[model samples]
Target: MRSSRARALEATINRLLAGGPKFFVKDHRAVSASGDPLRYPARTQRLDYEAEVAVVIGKGGRDIKSDDFTSHVWGYTLFNDWSVRDNVSFGPDFAYSKNFDTSATIGPWIVVNEGIDPQDIPIECRVNGELRQSGNTHSMVHSFAALGEHLSRDTTLWPGDLIASGTPKGTAVDSSRQETDGSFPDTLFVKPGDVVEVSSTLIGTIRNEVVKPTG
Candidate 1:
C-alpha cells in the first residue's frame, strides 16, 4: 500500500507497471477475537502489528464500479493486520510467515457508515501502552472505493466480507522509527507479554496480548 515510507511505496508502485495499489491475500484462519492472545509464531523473527481500517461489505456484486463502492459498504471497523517480518518476499515462505494462527485481529465492534468519513479517520497502534504507529486514512495511495473497484474487477464481493484497506505509515517495518540504536532485532518487534492495542475513535480498540505458545 502507498501508506508506507518512500522505499516501500516505491516498490509497491513499481510492482505493477500501471502503478496501482498492491494487494495480497491474508490467512482467513488467522482472524481471531479482539481480546484474544496473539500466539507467538514459533519461527517468526519479526512479529509486528499493522493498524488499519477495515470496511465491512454489506452489498455483494461482481466487477463493482468505483462510484458504486459505497453502496456495498455496510459499516466500518478496526483491524490489526499482524505480520511476520521474515521472508517478506512473496513466495512459499510468505504463506507460513503471515498465515500463522492468531496473526490478525478484527475489532471490538463496528460503527455503521452513516456520517463517518472513511477516507480520513485517525488510526494508531500501541505496544505495551507506548505509541508505535500514528496515521490517518488520508495518506492511503488508493481510496477504499478504488480498492473495491480493483478487487472486484472480476471477483464477487459478498456481504460480511471485510475489506482491510491498508495500514498507516508507522509500523515496526517503518524505517523512520528511531528506536533502540536503529534496528529491528528486538526493539520494534513485539514479543511475548507485550500488549498490542490498535484503536480508533470511529470504532473501538482491539487489544491482544502477545504470548508464547504452550503446545
Candidate 2:
C-alpha cells in the first residue's frame, strides 16, 4: 500500500480514539447496506466512498492463526467505508465523523469461501454510473487473514462480525488527478442524490444513494 493509504487508515484510527491509543477493529454500529441512502450531515463538506472487501466471521475465536482463517471464515461481501473528509485533519474525530448512521455500507450478500481466493479479486466504485476508483485485492497492503489474526489477538471475534479490508487507490481524494481537459469535472465528494455503487467480481454489487440528513 502507498504511504497515503496507510496515513488515511491511521488518521481514521486516531480520529476514533480522540487522542487515545490506536485501535484496529471498528464498532459494528457502523455497518449499513446496499440500496440504502447515505445521509449527509450538515456539518461536513466532503463525503467520500471507499470500496472494500468485507470478511464476515462465521466462526468465533480468539488469537486465531492466519493458517486457520479460512476455517473460521463465514464468507465475503462488498463494503463501502464512507467518510466525512472535512471532519478529518492531522487529528480526527473518527468516532463522531465515521460512526454516524449509514456510514458503513455492506452487502449485495455474502459469498461463502468454498473454492474462492480472496486475495485476487477486482474491486471498483462508481458514482452515478461513472467510474471513480479501480483497484484489486492483490494490491492490498495487508491480507484478509492477517487482519483477522491481528484483530483477534486481544479481542474475541464473534460470528457475524465483519472485518472490512482496507480500500485501494482512486478514492475521491484522487479527484484532483483527473483529466484537466474539462471533459468531465472532478469528483471530490458525494452529495445528495448521487448514487454510489461498489462492485466486486466475486461478491457482487452494493449500491447506495446519497441523501440529505433526515434528522
Candidate 3:
C-alpha cells in the first residue's frame, strides 16, 4: 500500500488542496478497443495497467440518489485504465499523460442483470498469464451508489456513458517499487509483445496485446 510514486502524488495533492476532494473529466478520445492491440506510445517510458470494473449508464439523469443507482445502471464490464507514468510530474498533467488514443480499454461485453452485486465481485489483472494485481470490490474505498450520486449531482449521466470504478492496488509499478528499491521492473510494465488481461467473475475478461505504433 505504501508506494513511492503514490506517496509523491499524495504529497502533491495535499499541497494543492485548499479544502476538499477534486475530480477531473477525461476526453472521450482516450477510449480504445477492448480486443485490439495496445499501441505503445513512442514518447512514454512506462505504460502501466490498472484493472477496473466499468459501469454503463442506462438512463440520463442529474442529482440521482444513491438508492436509485441500480435502476440507472445498464450493465457491468471490464476496463483497463492505462497510465503513462513517465509523462506524469509535479502537479501532474493528467490529460497529457492519460489521454492517448487506445488508453482506456473497455468491454468483452456488458452484463445486464439486476441481481448482480457490484460490491463483492472479484477483480484481477494478468500479464502474459501471470497475475499482477488482485482485489475485490468489497475493498473499494467508495461504493458505486455513492459515486453515481456524486457524479450526477452537477452533471447528467446519459445512457451509454461509462463510469470506471477506481482500480485496486497491484499495479506493475506498485509491485516493483514496493517489493524492491523504488525502481520499476522492466518485465512488469506493458511493452511490445506483452498480453494483458483484466478479468472479473461478474463480467468476463478483456484481453489486449501490446505492439509498437505503426504510425
Candidate 4:
C-alpha cells in the first residue's frame, strides 16, 4: 500500500524476491473489527496492530489497467490488520498469525471518491493517546490504482473488496525498537486495556480497546 513507499526500496525489492506479498484471506463471517474488543485467541507474545488505509472497490474487474483505476474505486476507509506475530511459530502461515476472529477491523464510515486526491493524505496511529506513527500518502510505493491493477491480475476484484495499504513506520514492530538479536522488545506490542486509534483527515478515526478474549 501507500504506507510502505516512504521506506527504502531495498526492503521492498527483497520482499518481492522472497515470495511476493504476505497475503491471506479473511473470514468475512467472523470479522468484528470495530465496536468490539481487539483480543487475542491465545496468549500471543506479540499482538501487533497494523494501522492502514483501506481502499473500497466499487466495481469488479479482472486485469484492470492502472490508468482506469479510478473508475473501479468506490471509496476509502480505515483498517487495522491486527496480527498475532509470535503465532507464526505454528508453521509460518498467515492463517496461523492473521486469520483469527477480531484480528482485523474496518471503518466507522467510508469517504466516497468523488473529488478526492488519494495521495499526499495524512495518516497516523496512536496507543493510549500517544502518537506512534505519522506519515502521508505521498510515501506510498503504489497508488491505489496501481494496487488495483496488480492485485486483479490473476483474479477478479468484486464489489466490496478492500485493499489495506501497508502500515507506516513506528508500528509496534517497526525497526525503531528492533533489538540486536533481530527481535522486537516485548514492550512494543499491545495488551489488554490498551486503546489504539487510527485516523486521518481524509478519512476518519477508528478507536478500539483491547480486552481479554471470550469463549
Candidate 5:
C-alpha cells in the first residue's frame, strides 16, 4: 500500500502534470509530542500492537461508487498500527498521531483480496508471547466498504491508500489499571526490552521489539 506521505506528493505531481502551478504540501513529518525538545515525542508510550486486516487500494478516484469498492481493493496485508497512548490522547483524534514514521510496520506479506471476506477475519495481540487482546473483525462498528464510501465522500481514494479499522476492545491499557495516585510502572507503559507479537488465525503472526530511542 502507498504511504500517506506518498499520496500527498502524488497530489502535487498530478496538479503539475496537468499544467497547474507547483504548490507543495507534505503531511508526514517526524516530531516528538512529550513537550521535551530533547526528548523525541512518542505517539504512544504504551505502544500497543494491533493485528489488523488491511486493505490495499488498487485504483484511485474521488467519489468511488460503493458497489465498486471491492474491485478497487488490491489485496490485504497484516498491519500493526503502533499506538502511543500518551500522544494519541493529546491531539489529532488518535488517527494522525498513530500514523508516524516506522509507526506503521506492515507486510510480512499480502493476501489476495479475492477469495476471503474482510469482516470474518480474527485478530489478536500478544506481549512477550502471551495473549493480551483478541477479537473478530466482525465486531468492527464500521466495515471496510462503509469506511471507503464515507472517506470518498469528501476525499479522493488512491491506489495503495490504507483505511485501518480502529483497534479492537482488548488493547493493553483496556486490560490494565492505574493506582489511586495515578502512577504506573514501565509495565503500565510498554518499555524497552519487551516484545509485542500480534496474530490472527487467518493472517498468522507479526512481532516487533520495544526499545527506547537513544539520546
Candidate 6:
C-alpha cells in the first residue's frame, strides 16, 4: 500500500513536459557511459550495477486482478539498478539512496510485452567484462503477474511506470561465498572507474562506469 518513489519521480517529470510524453525516463543505460550520460547525486560509495529488463506500464490501473495483468503491461527494456550499497544501508528511505539522479538506468529499446514472453528472457551481469551472474526469468520467485497484482493491492499504477524484476540469486554483494584463501579473503566488488555490464539476450546490454565520489 506504500507509494513507490520511483513512480512518483517519474510522474513529476512527465507532468513538467509540454507534450504528452510517451516514454519512461531511464536513469542509466550503459556500463561504459561517456560524455555526460547522466549520473546520480553525490554521497555514494560501492555502486553496484545490475542488468535487468525494465517493464514499462502502458495502461494504468488500481487493484488490478491477477488474471488481467497482461492488459496493463505495455513494453519492456533493459535496466541497470545502480546501487549505492553503502548509503542505502545507512539511509532512512531507499529513495535518497536508491532513487537518486540517475540511479535507475533503463532501455536501449522498448519491446512490447504483448509480443514477447517475459518468463524466458536470458539475463546476466558482468563486471569489467567478466561474467558474474546469469539466470533465466523463470527463476524469479515472483512472476510479473504476481508482482503486478501484489503492487496494485491497495495502490495505483500508472502508464510509463517501471517494475524491475528483482535481480537473480547471484547479484548481491555476497553473490559468491567462500572465496577464501586462509588469512586473506579474495573478494570482488565494483570500485570507481570499473566498467559494470548487465545484459539480457532479449535487450542486449546496459553499461556504466563506477566513478569514485569527489568531495
Quote model 1's TM-score: 0.87
- Cα lDDT of candidate 1 equals 0.82
Model 4 residue 140 CA deviation (Å) reads 1.7
Candidate with best lDDT: 1
Candidate 2 per-residue C-alpha lDDT over 170-206 given as tens digits, one digit per residue, 9 for 90 to 100: 7776454435563323366788999999998887999
lDDT of 4 at 71: 86
Model 3 alpha-carbon drift over 4 Å, by segment: 1-22, 87-92, 178-185
RMSD of each: 4.0, 6.0, 3.6, 4.6, 12.5, 11.2
Worst 10 residues of 5 by lDDT: 31-40
RMSD of 2: 6.0
Q: With candidate 1 superimposed using the best TM-score fit, by how many Å does residue 7's alpha carbon deviate from the native?
A: 5.7
* Residue-pair clashes per candidate: 0, 2, 0, 2, 6, 7
What's model 6's lDDT at 68?
Answer: 90
* Each prediction's TM-score versus the true structure: 0.87, 0.81, 0.85, 0.84, 0.72, 0.71
Residue 11, model 2: lDDT of 73
Return the TM-score for candidate 6, rounded to 2 decimals.
Answer: 0.71
| Models ranked on lDDT | 1, 3, 2, 4, 6, 5
Which candidate leads in TM-score?
A: 1
Give model 4 RMSD, 1 decimal.
4.6
lDDT of 2 at 212: 96
Total backbone clashes of candidate 4, pairs 3 or more residues apart or in separate chains: 2
lDDT comparing candidate 2 with the true structure: 0.78
Assess the local accuracy of residue 46 in candidate 4 as a C-alpha lDDT between 0 and 100.
79
Q: 35-89, model 1: which lDDT tens digit per residue?
A: 8999999887788889999999999999998898988999998989888886576
Q: All models: lDDT?
A: 0.82, 0.78, 0.81, 0.77, 0.62, 0.64
In candidate 5, the residue pairs with backbone N, CA or C atoms under 3 Å apart (3 or more residues apart, or in different chains) clash, namely 2-160, 32-41, 33-41, 43-84, 44-84, 44-85
